[model samples]
Target: MADIVNLRMARKARARKLKEAEAEANRARFGRPKAERLKMERELERAARIHEGHRRETPGEEA
Candidate 1:
């Protein structure tokens, strides 16, 4: 015979587990330090500026 389980406790436990999983996911997603994120953003912006600087304009393609 299977042991009886309390439904309320089981439900609460499951909710706790799901909440923990979401928190873990959020930590991984947004875990970068502010300085590191800012540095990355600056590097990306510099790269974009360089890329745009190197672009050649076609005479007939003006929009």
Candidate 2:
């Protein structure tokens, strides 16, 4: 005896496969990944400055 499968389940499976295929294609075209980007280092330096500016507490200020 053969087991019957639901129709809706098959449609959902097809949609998920198509989305995965598109993501793979995009990765190949972009070439260098996020780790290799020069901008990453520059952004890190900029963030450090902003946080340091906020952390300074003035003398005699109320707790």
Candidate 3:
């Protein structure tokens, strides 16, 4: 029981470390700021708006 508990803790710790590393890498690459986030959101929304009319639905599938 003690070994199993220890193993679980070790696995959780490793996963947490990996997540933190990934977040840091993402921040470094993308440089998250409020302005940038808003800009990205607006760009995505514009793309969706532009493509809305171009989507073709499959037969028998109700969108």
Q: Which candidate should be chosen as best, given TM-score against the real structure?
A: 1
Query: Clashes per prediction?
Result: 0, 0, 0
Candidate maximizing lDDT: 1
Which of 1 and 3 is the better model by lDDT? 1
Q: How would you encode candidate 2's per-residue C-alpha lDDT over 1-63 as one tens digit per residue? A: 989988799889988899988888877656667776567668988998798778768557777
- How well does model 2 score by local distance difference test? 0.79
lDDT of 1 by residue, 1-63 (tens): 999999999999999999999999999668989988889889999998898788798457887
Answer with 1 or 2, whichever has the higher lDDT: 1
Off by over 4 Å in 3: 1-17, 25-31, 56-63
Tell me model 1's lDDT, rounded to 2 decimals: 0.91
Identify the superior model by lDDT, candidate 2 or candidate 3. 3
Per-candidate local distance difference test? 0.91, 0.79, 0.85
- For candidate 1, the per-residue lDDT at 22 reads 100
Cα-based lDDT at residue 50, candidate 3: 79
Query: Judged by lDDT against the true structure, how good is candidate 3?
Result: 0.85
The residue pairs in collision within model 1 are none
Model 2 misplaced regions, further than 4 Å? 31-63
